[model samples]
Target chain A: MIRTFYGTDTLNSPAAFFIALTIGFFFGLTLERAGFGSSRRLAGIFYFKDMAVLKVMFTALLTAMIGLSFCIGLGVIDPSTEIYFMKTYYGAYIIAGLIFGVGFVMSGWCPGTATVGMASGKLDAVVFLAGSVLGSIFFNELFSIVKPLVTWGQSTQQNMGQEGLAFVYNSLGMSKSAFGFLFTLIAVVCFWGSEYIEQQHSDEIGKTGYFNTPFLRAFSLILMVSAGGLFVLDGSVNAEKHKAVSSSYGLHMSEKALLRDVASAVDHVEPEELADYLSNQDPAVIAVDVRPAKEFNAFHIRGAFNAELPDLPQFVQHHTDKRMIVLYSNGMTHPAQARDSLARMGFRNVYLLTNGLGGFIERCLKPVSLRKEPMPENSIRQINLWRAYFYSFDNARPSVIGSNPSADSAKFSDMPPFLPGFVDADWLAVLMEKPGLKMIDFRDQPEYNTNHISGSYAMSIENFRGVLDGVPSMLMPANVIAARLSLMGIEPVFRFSQKRR
Target chain B: MSSGNQKPYSNPYLAGVFLGVVLLASFLLLGAGLGASSGIARLGAFLSGLILPTHTFSSEYFGAWGEKPLHYYLVFMLLGVFLGGLFSAILSRRVQKSVVEKGNAISSKIRLIYALTGGILVGFASRLAGGCTSGQALTGGALLLTGSLIFLICVFAGGYAAAYFVRRQWHD
Candidate 1:
């Protein structure tokens, strides 16, 4: 029997590396073949110049996905043997996807395609690749600030060994085959729809005299083969890995059961046992204060360490082997929220302080002053805002500490650096002075409204792409920005910082 | 010269079929789906390490990649893709050194600027989204993820919405 290599079980095996390499190679080849190497070709989809990209992508997706499902149904592939699908991190994926898509349309080639394009001799592809590398580096440098969102976004069952699409499907009372069929149907519809749209716009595209090129055809064929090869290699390797691991460790309960047991184990630990564990030196029980910085600072358990809830997983991951991680928040919601988030990220031994911080104070701390004074609504709102700001700042501080000292020192240096996206404020000023300029801030609504640069329109980062609907420039349409500026009764020569740098 | 040099693109349906086979092969062979951004992210992690090793090692996100060398599965996969694309390009005699730009109305400089800016945004956004267009739209969408579907819709909407305004760059 040909063994299947699964993601979960392949980690410790030597074959995993080779499997990963083969999969990666095909993935890259397909992308290049798809003309994803060319910015113009990629952006052409938006302009209705070509829809082959969408069609080819969907067709491939349906083919592989349905095949996997079919294999599972036939018992040729055990669904449980593989790492199940991950839960939707709705907030993170939605926000990130929008930004990424805008970037995709704007940049012309995504990171993978750009690399291929660079190999194929495209200068723009090289520039784009450089930009992505820089951008990712920038992201890491600023991870402290962005850690909350990143951590929150990454939360899922995959981390906990309890999360999987199969569990969710079972909960919904739908068989795997049924869900697969539904999914396949939807994919087919989308493929057909995209094709229909392409046909509708074919005349317009053909008129541009760009569609019938031999170069494009060859690229398409190569892309198709690579894409197909990648799928086959990935599935086979993973399936084999899965078989090997399963044979070694017999059929275990699903990841869901494992996660549930973990959660329950943490929950079942009596308060006395926890207190005993905390008092004991070997079992090291850490009190995790998961509230905003202001709240944590104002009043928290004496021994509790302030690791923001969103950041608890990373903290735990880094400081492994903790006996108990008792997370507390201001109210009831935060403890459960934080606990769930951490659990999803595969952190074991995480517990929600029952009744939260309030409970802890009432039970353990026994504060002398139990003053219940409900502040006015406005004051309460102000306190909340301050707390949020301070919390974010506090959560962000650690990453700064963790990042390379050299990079931080360089930030303090006077020497000019040629960072890809780091535009000088002075240069921005120059661009701002150019005629017909408009600026759109793509930070979150609260962040934008709080202290955006003057004359910049407030477009929330969450729905940044929504503003582009019918506008040009995927980054920020000059015309729309201009119109907004014209409406504001101001005309500038340049559009600076239209979207996030 | 134009006729001799021009290579026709494969039929869309045929291309789609070939691509589908590849996708199926990935499933049967790898037991995992395709993703582009992770590979890019791995690259990012690798570069960050080269530039600032200490910081990259400490980063919760980038640190994951720091556990291994820069050339992982994704990197190799990407390399293979380039080779495959080159192979195809060569076979069709379509390999040429040229800048694919909009009409003469738009300067190469402008296109390059947009491309750079766009690349930066996309890179940042992919990290935010936890994936890119290929990972989310193609892979996840095939899996029938609601978020991916929503993302796919928004992408097309966002693109078309921006198309008309940028018409001067492409259409003019």
Candidate 2:
């Protein structure tokens, strides 16, 4: 992607300041060149003795409008993301315009032209500039009183939730390219009208051949054709791109089918069953962590691919129906919502992690002696396997201390509450003195080379994930990971493979 | 009175096309449009800050920008515009020390008073509208913003209507 300064705080950078200055320079130069430095000429427009302002304004508007449409059509910039579309405060804008218009006629100079006039050493313009500053101070002083008028329609706009750039064409329900074409045609007519009016007011010599310019005619023709080209291109290519941008997330399954699945309780997997599948590294099962990146990075179920809710549909489509897809978050609510939506979307194998990750930690990874009731033999075995695989501790520490395992006796008090699978900065600082600590940096090679903990083995996380059933990043079997670790001259500590960036 | 030394203005259409390209460049590089009132308003705030620092920084209108209101994109833009206009005027020999008004009709003092009054109205209206001719009309109009288009039409309509009342000030 060609990164412009969009969606960044670089606007206040010195570079951006210089760019604005350059743009302003050209703007002022062009305005002065167009005779906008003369207040008499500006006022002449209102008097109908001159129409340069109208002609220039409209021509400029058309040029920029058409150019923008072309840029959007060619995908040089995405308007939906890149452009800062000002909100429509209808009443405030129109009222401001009327007041501003009256002021323009009375002053004979708008803010920009007045600056030029002042530069041309017009004493009246200097007075006008002073008046503008005083006026701003006046507005600031009385802002509380005028606040309602200034934000007249803001509440209604907020209620409508019409946050997109309310372009004229969008409000009119017409495509952008079509609007550009129509606007270009309108400008041609206006230009002709301006010329006619100017000619009528001019002397005999000036009126002789006002419409006889071949260059003007040729330019108008070129503008119209370019607008038409944009129209066609936008309709054919950009329309579909726009559709894809606005996701098709509507449900595909019948309401009855969804309700039946919900009632039958087949939409979720128990923590014990999921643990068993994960412990054996079942190739048919895939766990997707739906939590935000920060939480997932802090601690997540091993072998789970981190994904967002919006991305789930596309990600699920890539898998076969035979693979069991389990979705999970910190709590049951997020996974349950995902399961319901996925089921309605006609995905058959999508299942939620029952009671979410909390359930897995409590029922599947908790020590057998910590349980309130005596657990069955198979459940105990599965829990021990899950604890060892996920926490990387051979039942030596409580996997999750905050959950408060039943019987919080002093026996578990001495164990640090730090998550068993991940070590914090403090833990690493303390462990650095020990000879047994085998640190593996999972960040890229360049980052590892720049600066990393001393004596840590550098390994790319990519080596531990291979394509499984056309889905990338499905963890390789546990034995493969173990073999990779052993080759690096380190005994298999599953936590070492966790991404440490 | 013709100076007999200065060149004529460029064709309006040519000038407009160049201005449009400048506007397009702004959108492409900065992802925003042009403006004049904002810079002037910030200048106002900065000046006010110099006089009464606490009030200027605490007032709802100018306070949002915090201290150093002049440290902004529009402030530099305004400075550039002043310098650019000065350069262009000097080159074209249009730089003259005089008041602009109807020839031999309105006195320079009266014309200056009228200009000041008009400036005040425009400056206040621009702030109320959140933009001015350059920012809202030219920039937003090019983008086809509905509010800006509405503002553009109203400005012309309102100007023509008010011109009747102000005609004596300009017409000889």
Error of 1 at B148 (Å): 3.6
**Model 1, span B5-85: residue lDDT tens:** 745565544555556566555555555555666667677787667777765665556654534545455455555566766
lDDT of model 1 at residue A119? Answer: 64
Where is model 1 more than 4 Å wrong at Cα? Answer: A1-3, A11-14, A28-35, A151-161, A164-196, A203-501, B1-6, B67-71
lDDT of 2 by residue, A268-290 (tens): 78776788888798989989999
Candidate maximizing TM-score: 2
lDDT of 1 by residue, A1-501 (tens): 234565444532446556655655565555555655556666777776666677666656656665555555345754434533444655656666666666667666776667667766677877786777667767767766766565343223332223323133343466444554555455445545655566667655453322335644454444344335444554665575565445434333345544444433434333333344444433457777777788666555545688875677678886668767777676657767666566555565677665565544343333222222222344345444433432343332222221333322333222123323233354445455444445677644434433567877755433323336675325555665566556655665322344226
Total clashing pairs for each candidate = 69, 0
Estimate every model's Cα lDDT from 0 to 1: 0.57, 0.77
Q: Residue B8 in model 2: shift from native, Å?
A: 0.7
Residue-wise lDDT of candidate 2 within B91-149, one digit each (tens)? 99888877464546677777777888989989999998889999999888998888899
DockQ list for all candidates? 0.24, 0.36
CA RMSD, predictions in order:
20.2, 16.2
